[model samples]
Target: MTVNDGTATGTTHGSMADAELVSTEVLLAKPKRVVREDLKMPDGRVIDWYFMDTPDSVMVVPLTNDGRLVFVRQYRHNLKKHCIELPAGAVSAGEDPAEAALRELEEETGYRLAEGEELVSLGRFYSLPSETNKYTNFYFARVTWDHEPILDNEIEAYFDMSVVTIPAADVFSRLAGEINGMETAGALMLSQRYIAAA
Candidate 1:
């Protein structure tokens, strides 16, 4: 199938039929924007699709020199619980994904790339294509916690952020249980492939 979005045309080879976007309504615009889209199906059916319209973000898996994984345990209001996950944050406008990953690692866990260390890009993935347009870049880096964390006001106010370290080998097992977030789990799984190849 081919789609012409007024500027460029692209062909998609897929079994599922495409839905034409009819209209869009902005539901919320603060913190993050929520949008509702009306679509017309190929079969003359109409549907409403709700999703978040936001900038891309980054997630970092920081491995210490001692071979430990750095994570953050933060309170998630939506879940009403503290969840452990990799350091992550939205990429500000005009900011590079790698830079955002490094900034988040420092801000969340006080870990910074040491001399000769680098932030390695694992690649990017959709946060949830069915629900949003936000894509998150995944990164891995060897770091050192030589300074105190400098939490942003929003994070400090909204979450009780605490840095946690664990053996890097235990990440897969912890992710299989309830000790990690899905995004972290996904990033770690991808990191395994990179580690294996290295």
Candidate 2:
């Protein structure tokens, strides 16, 4: 597909950065949405309404030549439960998704990638359309080490997401319910497309 620089309107074949939609109009405006606070059917009732615009984020599935996929199992105080998600976080001010993924990988997982193998951009994703305007970029990092992964301070204490691998053949099972996060799911979906093409 024909592509535009710094736009994601309809581009399908260019570098993702070229297609990464950064339209100020789309990014700047508050979400144009409404929530109804009161509902009257056969009986009159009231509830609540809220409007929100979610943040831009990133998700990663760090891989090593030895065939390990970095997975983080953390306690989500908000959800009040633990989920096995890949390392991830929101993109910071003026930060690129790929760069954020790399930094988050090191900060959360402490596994360094070899100098050359960097992120292969998967694509952009939207989360929770009902209330969020967030976009998450998926990334893959290749590690060169042959040992167990080390963990960062807060991550080590709050969550037990030590890097581990699910066999290539068992991905559908391991990552089935919630073994991965939203971005991880997106990345795996893209990777499946890559594998199918091969």
Candidate 3:
């Protein structure tokens, strides 16, 4: 069947035969898209579903040749606090996820893969399957300091981000404490498995 509410339209296919979209209202836009969608069920009942529409991104778990994990400390305006997280960033339009991982590593931590070092893919994950469509691709890389971190102008001015390096062995212990982002923790788990298997 088909449903439209002036601004948005939705159609039900074979798998969604029992559900139909009634309407959709955009709550927030831009970098993070949030919306409220109304749906009609097979029982003639309507319900509201709120979700986020975000672009896929990449997260890097950078390891220095000497076995240090490269992290970044930055202010999170939403939390009104500083957070320690892995080097990560959004994958630019038409850019490869691996390339984005490498770029974020260098941009946020001033670290880049050495001549013989390589970027290893751990895998990809949905940051919040129920709430957002954003998938984060994870990678493990051994890097060396090449230059100072170059943050985006807004990040530099508002977040005051700084690079922090810690022993890879300490990651688990740190994760047991108050880590900020769930995506970062998930990335750590995947990277740990990758390291163990290698």
Among these predictions, the greatest TM-score belongs to 1
Better of 1 and 3 by TM-score: 1
Which residue pairs clash in candidate 2? 73-161
Residue-level lDDT tens digits of model 1 in 145-184: 8788888786465698889998877667776575757789
- What candidate 2 gets wrong by more than 4 Å, as runs, is 1-49, 145-157, 178-181, 193-198
lDDT of 1: 0.83
Candidate 3, residue 166: lDDT: 80
Error of 2 at 88 (Å): 0.6
What is the Å distance of residue 80 in model 2 from its true position? Answer: 3.0
Q: lDDT per prediction?
A: 0.83, 0.62, 0.82
Q: Pick the candidate with the highest lDDT.
A: 1
The residue-by-residue lDDT of candidate 2 on 12-106, one tens digit each, is 34332233222222333432333333323222233333434556788876666655566667787778888777778768779887888877777
Question: What CA RMSD would candidate 2 show?
Answer: 11.3
**Superior by lDDT: candidate 1 or candidate 3:** 1
Clashes of each: 0, 1, 0
